[model samples]
Target: MEITTLASTWPAALTDPSGRRQLKPRTKGRTMVIDKGIGLHAFTDLLATSGEYIDIIKFGFGTSPLYPLPVLKNKIELAANQGITVIPGGTLLEAAVRLDMVPGFFRQVLALGFTGVEVSDGTINLSRGLRNDLIKDAKSLGLTVFTEYGKKLFGSRIDVDDFANTAEQDWSCGAELVTVEARESGKGVGLFDERGDCRDDDLSHIRSVIPNLSRVLWEAPLKEQQVSLIKTLGPDVHLGNIPVHDVITLESMRRGLRSDTFELQQVPFLEYMI
Candidate 1:
């Protein structure tokens, strides 16, 4: 069968049982994948296969500098062609801040064709003024700015008031969204406890503070974290730090195509089975 015909034959209800926002250029239900050094071919395959489900691609934790200039440019071009916003990991920006090389960093990032920039202080101490300045700087360059809230320390947790204040200031300074740090391990940091489980009370408190949940992208690299967030926040929650291989799986969960989220359909047992 032809590819278009094959796609046409699939029932929409079966494919997207949860009534998710399926199209891109999405303000909500965005997924940001973290690239921690996948080869060019794998990266190509990822965009080819699951680009529709991805809204942003983050070159995780300074890995953008590790790629050859040509290779990095090619990757950025590919993602941009698919309407995906690409950004270097925030750690690299933090490094530039520490070295007082902010101008050079922004210059190279624009030269590299990155469509966006992440301003974060995960491993560094950034005063409120500096943070706002970084956000404004990226915005001035016509790059989409994504700021990060919370620290990356092993036992760090989000203080509700601080998070609210940071997110508010970030938006005021022109950040499109602020991401919560859950690290790649999804354990012992930010919203998750040492066992990689979501702190329900904390999550609830944070949710209460932010009326528009889409403004906060929660980094959930683990399956359990993804499931928990989906269950708690509904299917349209923005998620980040997703592993490349799990893109399709995460999409499945978002659309209720997987058992973990199948009940999101709210269909009767017999009707679903049939």
Candidate 2:
């Protein structure tokens, strides 16, 4: 499928500060936004303004079932048409797993026009075998599968060995990416400290064990966290759980348009040679 990027209308004098924020269909530097009950009009407005910068739109948590059927369907359809993948929050799948409704989950997902599924165990105990099956099942139905690591509980931290093992297994099972959970609040969870700051030691540990960083998506909902990850990992790191309104802001930071990363690129020449 041909992904259409917004025209690069600006002059060549302005280069991305990081020097390599590729346009979609991009395999790296992906941003996944979270939709917390946004209406149809607002959803459409967001897509119209910044859809190209977004890779996925997750209907946050269990809120996916709360939307009117038509609104939900339209939102998924719009995202798919714009080349953006759409999936229900991982918590929804957890609910299905708990209730033994995995089949229904996939059926409803496809019936609703969602292009992806997030198989997560943040709130439930999913055996590794089950997790693998879920990933494969989603792939068999032609959905892009995104499995997640980390628990949703407060103060939960990632286990490097377990995470590395699970990530490899998930990939072998055909999952596209593995998201590290940060919940909606990015504090005291996963790689974040109590104050929403990143735990660099933990991040480095994870990186050391994982062979490929490109397959992992860190959920950084806060601007500071996003900036920190972009600076530490370069702009190609895949990030998730971004709020809808912050799409352009995150993209700006990715391209070094913001002060936090303005030094990422060489200084622009003051003398224009027209």
Candidate 3:
């Protein structure tokens, strides 16, 4: 007699949270975390439980310069081993620009093992020509390049035309995405009013020029900012400056698994692809 056996599978329990698809690596549905300083042990613990949910991990600011060489090397190796593209924060690069150490900085990065670089003038005056040149230099070093826009100030509101022009220039120079700066806080900055509400008119203005809107990553460090952007721009909008703990929560919000996007689930009914 022949017997058929079934594999045992447990359903998602009621005590657990909502359903959401974990994104694949190198996803445009990205969550870029700004790491100010996470020691080796804490970083390891973070990766152990949440590595799958993190896409890019940056060594925030020039804090990379302060870490013991061995510790930083180990951290970079660990993240890269798990296929996470590790890069130093753009502020660090801005510092390099300040010290005329761009080459030396990248030499250290390559020597220590980083797979990416961010080019931004958030804290400096990187003119259009120099910015493009910097992008080329980073690509020449075989780093995945991401550029950022907007100033890091309390009232640094975006002018849509300027943002669009800069974004196009950055893209033409080979940046993977242009990040809208929020500087670790979502309030009183780009796309956000004093209370952290998203500016609908600003988004509309940029979209009018940036045909490939998917390439713009909103730097949403707060929960409400992420929720608001997802609701307005759809689940596929790319977000940056996301805190490590909220990675899954951000993903849940994107996929309509959270209360914020529950209304988004009611799109115009369409036939299934199949």
Candidate 4:
């Protein structure tokens, strides 16, 4: 299918009304899509269509190892050329740590043209010292390290103090951002309840306690969670685990072009700013 051009005349928020979000090249309110083994052609199509709205792309799980070397390199380069960062999933890092292959993983990531890496222990146990060392090492290698907070098990719960402590440590050690862990399914883990809804009370409480909400990327893969989060935290809340297809759709929701948020269409973009 042919891609549609985003002509400037399209009324800034006609599609994504959250016009306040600092578009491309911005650090805040970033939209990251998870790449779950989409082929090269489709991947190219996705970038061609929604590249403007995307900031980061994670090759979900250990799929990085599954891809042929040439294919992976091409994918990474293609994404980077469009000003979109390509990063290995955090779970992949956990596998590296498990196999004592952190160095190897870092080397391969750069060699394959990936611009970023995520250091996470959502499935494994990692001490603060090791996590900090990994963050420092990745940063030293010029890799944009996005650390993750929380476990991947079903019904995994988050303690505000623990998450806050981890966020502070990761940021202090030069991590670009900290991810709130929500496995790809977005269900029964991290912030989401068994039904995959963003637990408002939990989210509110965590927000109240965390000193830096901007540093934490909420893993909201569901549309409802995204809407609720953007509404509660305003349009600029950094969100992660968005589906590849919903990249532009989520962008629309953020910009207030979607039906759910169209009611706020009259408000000025500046009013949504912090």
Candidate 5:
């Protein structure tokens, strides 16, 4: 059967088991993939197979500067054509801020065709004024701004009050989303513990304070972290830092097609099994 027809033939009970949105330009359930230097062919393959499931693509760290100008622009243009927001990693932004090159950075990003910017202080300290300015600057340029909370330091944990305050400020400054930092390792930072376990209490507290959970994106690079966040926050929760190869796998878990979330299906079993 053709791929489009296969879903139609599935048991009615199995269709849309999780009732989550499946189309692109989705407001919630966003997935942000981290590109840690994949080649153009690999990148093209990723977009070909899984672009529909992606909402954003982050060029990990300062590597965006290292890519040949033409290659970087091509990648950004490809993602834009797929309706995916492309951004340089926050670390690069932090570097720009430190070097007093924020203006040049934004110009380069826009000229290169990136559609968004990640304003984060993961590796360095950014004053509230500076952070807000960065968000505003990006917004003034008609760029999507995604602000990140939490530090990248090992064993860094979330302070609920601080997070709440920062998130509010970020939104007021025109940030479209606020991401909680879990780094690429998905361990010992923000919501994850040293062993990469999701800190349930912290996550719960964050959800309680943040009225619109859809505006919050949790960086969950590990499979276990993804599973835990989805199970706790439901499938529509925004997750980021996903590896390229795992895009389909993550979408499967979100839609209840995978065993981890199979029970998320609304219908009871066996009746449709035969």
Candidate 6:
């Protein structure tokens, strides 16, 4: 079976409302989708529809090991071919740590053609030294490492100073970026409050300490959260944990094609150059 990408059929100037949005091989404005067991056809449909807009596809929360080997390989290969980095969720690495199977996990991931790995301790208690070591190990294996800060439990919130410290070490140790844990629901954990609203103060504090906001990926799966973050961080903030069906919708919002951000890129002063 063959598949096609939207970019092949559409003209770039006509597709993007905001002409300033960067093309893929992009550093900023990355969108990472969470794949929680969508089948091969659906995955193909997603790439065919919005692959150019997607930067990463995370096989969520220990589910990478659940797929049939062929399906998993196909998913990774397909995403790779489209320039998307495919990674198993951080929780899978935490599980391996608990089972003393870290070596095997890295071995299997490389063998399976994953381009990256997420190293997190949302559930397990990992020491700072161990976390850095894990980051280094992944780097040595030639896999991009995405570290995570904050616990996965409900009511867990960001400690700005601690997050700054960890992010510094993670990046120094060679992590590609650090993700704030909002889980799949985008509620009651990390950046979100019980009602799913962002804790804006926490975000501000984190930003104050972290020199580069581009190195942070906010796991915002809800539409409202996406809009708020984009409005706050502008259209280029790295967002993760997006649902499969919402890929195009999220891409539309990112490019200011959606009403919520339609005028986001308009610089009124630029129109009146004297």
Query: Candidates' lDDT values, in order?
Result: 0.92, 0.91, 0.82, 0.86, 0.92, 0.91
Model 4 Cα shift for residue 93 (angstroms)? 1.4
Number of the top TM-score candidate: 1
RMSD (Cα, Å) for all candidates, in order, is 2.8, 5.2, 5.3, 5.2, 2.9, 5.1
Error of 3 at 178 (Å): 0.4
Residues 10-62 of candidate 5: C-alpha lDDT, one tens digit per residue: 76446577776668899989999999999999999999999999999999989
Residue 188 lDDT in model 1?
Answer: 98
lDDT of 3 by residue, 1-274 (tens): 8749764754343212333344457555777777778788988987897787677888876789898999999999998888888999998899999999988988998999999999998889998899999999989889999998988989899988899989888999999889998878788998998888888888788777776788888899999888877777767678888776777787667656678877644345679997
Off by over 4 Å in 3: 1-22, 263-274
Native RMSD of candidate 5 (Å): 2.9
Rank by lDDT (best first): 1, 5, 2, 6, 4, 3
lDDT of 4 at 20: 72
Tell me the TM-score of model 1.
Answer: 0.94
TM-score of 2: 0.93
Q: Worst ten-residue run, lDDT, model 5?
A: 1-10
Q: Comparing 1 and 6 by lDDT, which wins?
A: 1
**Could you tell me every candidate's TM-score relative to the true structure?**
0.94, 0.93, 0.87, 0.91, 0.93, 0.92
The lDDT of model 2 is 0.91
Of candidates 3 and 2, the better by TM-score: 2
Supply the global lDDT for candidate 3: 0.82
Better of 1 and 4 by lDDT: 1
Q: 191 in model 6: Cα distance from truth in Å? A: 1.1
